[model samples]
Target: MWLKLNKTFFGTGTHIYLCAVYIPPLNSTHTADDLLNLEAEIANYSKYGDIALIGDFNARTGEQADYIENENNSIQFLQDMLPQDYDLDSPIKRNNLDILNQQGNNLLNMCLSSRLRILNGRYLGDSLGYHTYFSKNGCSTVDYAILSKDLLPSVEYFCTSDLNFLSDHVQISFKLKCDIKQYINKKDFNNNNMKKFTTYRWTDVSHGKMYEALNSDEVKNKILNFEITHFVRNEKGINEASKSLTEILDNVASKTCIIKVPIKQKKSKIKKNPWSDNELKDLKSKINNLGKKTKT
Candidate 1:
């Protein structure tokens, strides 16, 4: 195709074989065969380590079945005997593409063969799979980010940025899980810092309420009246605009979104029995006899 780069990152827990590619465009000298070959080359490294393939594949894989889904009416015994296919719970991917082409089929085949899963429609940010490439010819999703099953769980967020960043194709951004279990609101990252604030999961906000509030005239007017151009003018302006927007969102979110604070369970204390006397045992027997007499 055009160009490809392979980089290996060694982590404490795992090693990632990242293969970035810029495959040749659709009707040119390069074609879908190159995509299959790329998958083969990438799959070859699975023997060594985990894989993460991200790049402009020039392959518009619209709303395609990237993985071979398990048979709905498969027999339990047969399924157990042959568990080659991945998880049975196949999630539906909502895409923005109008149609799936040959390149899409080839791309899906590559994903299936490579044992990789696309992160676009699967993540919170790109839940509605946005088109990555746009031009006069039309819009399509040619860029992609795929990861091994193990690495898939670690992806905290994934989204495709708009072309406002000075590019014909939208940029893809993703985050990996990190330990931020507890912390004081910007005080210090130290064990002694016990003054921790109750953190609310903003990511798990009520989208229904959010959209409703944002679409309201009150919120919409606030957004419209505020100078949007000032957002990119200067650092001070950016912060000011961001704070204003955050305030507006937080105000509505406070009313709608439920706060998810982790419950801290207090450890239970156990005490030894105090009845070590024979007399107490006899008294208990007498009480039992009295209770039987009362019943009779």
Candidate 2:
């Protein structure tokens, strides 16, 4: 299992935490305790952000018309392990199936206790004609996307597709309706546009020159005769006065100081790996070309 954290969802400041997991098949060496431990680990991250747990839990939920008994303890383990906040959702809902197996009963009991509504059941109605997983015996929906209550509104579509002909298990896709505009901040935009200048280094010679310029008869007279009334009588006027002062200071500094320009360094070439020679480079290039053609 792994947790993927996304700080930005479209343009909104909402955070989304997706926990992807896979429970071993019934015949595997892993025990029910292992599945319970995995659920506990997933629950630890749910408090940080909106959680969406999507995975293959090998439990045979008796939601299909031709339901057969499977001896998987995943459903019972998960039902006891998961927190009260999480909701189990699946495309396949109980309709044609008259009997509830151990897995189905455990899942149903968890939903009832948590007051969780299944997303597929809410949107797609009672039954799904298509199944997610196909086997020699029959087809069944073993994969699921369990989500937190807060994420339900954002869910747009949830269904299965048989696009991957190589695999028996069909892919399940879900769409979320995200509003991009909510993520942009106007204050950050204004801050980016604001101008900032670096302070000039003052040597002894430059300092003497600036002192002489400031003490000159013409410069002294300008400062003495300067009046606030010359500009408008508001915040804009104060800004104008500040701009004039800055201009005078800049002029003095330009005449006195020898401004330094930072030099840009040339980037050195990357040394090739000793093991990767011309033969490996040629092989990699051919593989990339083949991949590009396949994509097109």
Candidate 3:
């Protein structure tokens, strides 16, 4: 289906035509060839100064094609579709090496024309939470951008991250210092027509009642509540620290009891017994007394 967006912006006369069109979603009965035809039509329309064809083409580029032994069909589709003068580059190419090293899945979301120079480009993996938006389990790149080739030299930095503070798709942006010399050499500047006109003064737009009402009891209470909460947290932290210091000092000042050691005793050797004369005399007297008693 072909649709014409009839709004002409910036005074139309085929000098520099800038357009943004919504291409049909992929795999909707229409084949890749159909998408190519759509791209060719845009290329035809962009024959003027510069053309930037952007949006999700749904065609995978870069590392996505690295594994396929025969990428001719896909590459040929893009070459035939896009204008020959245009340049193509995926900012995701910077992460392509790392992706390949990790054997990652590539979605190839970017392309540029030869007319455009790539100052910088990258896949916003984790810096933007792009993966979470897509419902992908982990961080990955599925967004990208391409700049005109003429604009490459002045590029300062090209980069991305997986921070999910914005849209789920990774945002690709770049900075370029416009070559003022080119415009100067082209004699595009007219100094005589750039003079400033007369001046004007400013006036206050606030209402007298509104200014007075801003200092209401409700506002004062809200401000006081915030201050009280902050002060309470600070005071609580100080109290906790003071109590911890006292406990630590008390533990350090406590007296400790020391243990004493016992000494070892040596054992004596055994002595042999010898017969005595007093023991022999006592035995003879006991035998004689016993014999006399028996005779009586």
Clashes of 2: 1
> 2 or 3, which is superior by lDDT?
2
The CA lDDT at 245 in model 2 is 78
Local distance difference test, each candidate: 0.70, 0.59, 0.39
- Best candidate according to TM-score: 1
Please give, for residues 1-296, the per-residue lDDT of candidate 2 as tens digits.
Answer: 35554566364335666656576765777567545565465466655666666767555554432222241434566677778775444333343222344554444444333333344333443235345678788766666665665667777767666635347787766766767556656665563343233446778787678768887886676676564238776779768887877777776777678765444446899899989989999999999999999999
- TM-score of each prediction: 0.52, 0.44, 0.32
Ranked by TM-score from best down, the candidates are: 1, 2, 3
Instruction: Please list all clashing residue pairs in model 1, or write none if there are none.
Output: none
Weakest ten-residue segment in model 1 by summed lDDT: 1-10
lDDT of 3 by residue, 1-296 (tens): 22222223222222333333334344456555544454465466555444333334333333443223344556676786778784333332233322321112212212232233222223223222122114455444333334433334444655554455335545545444433343243333454333232222222422333334335564445445544543333667657655655443333222111212233345676543465466877898999999999999
Q: Which stretches of model 1 miss by more than 4 angstroms?
A: 1-12, 75-89, 92-94, 178-296
RMSD of 1: 16.4
lDDT of 3: 0.39
Q: Give the winner by TM-score: 1 or 3.
A: 1
lDDT for each residue of candidate 1 in 1-296, tens digit (9 for 90 to 100)? 11212222222135566777777777887445667677777767777667777788777777777766664656465776766874553545646554677777777787777777888777888888888888999888878888776677788988998785347888898886634443224446554344244444545456666767867888778777674445565668768887887777666766567765545667788653695577877898999999999999
Q: Given candidate 3, what's the lDDT at residue 267?
A: 65
Order of the predicted models by lDDT, top scorer first: 1, 2, 3
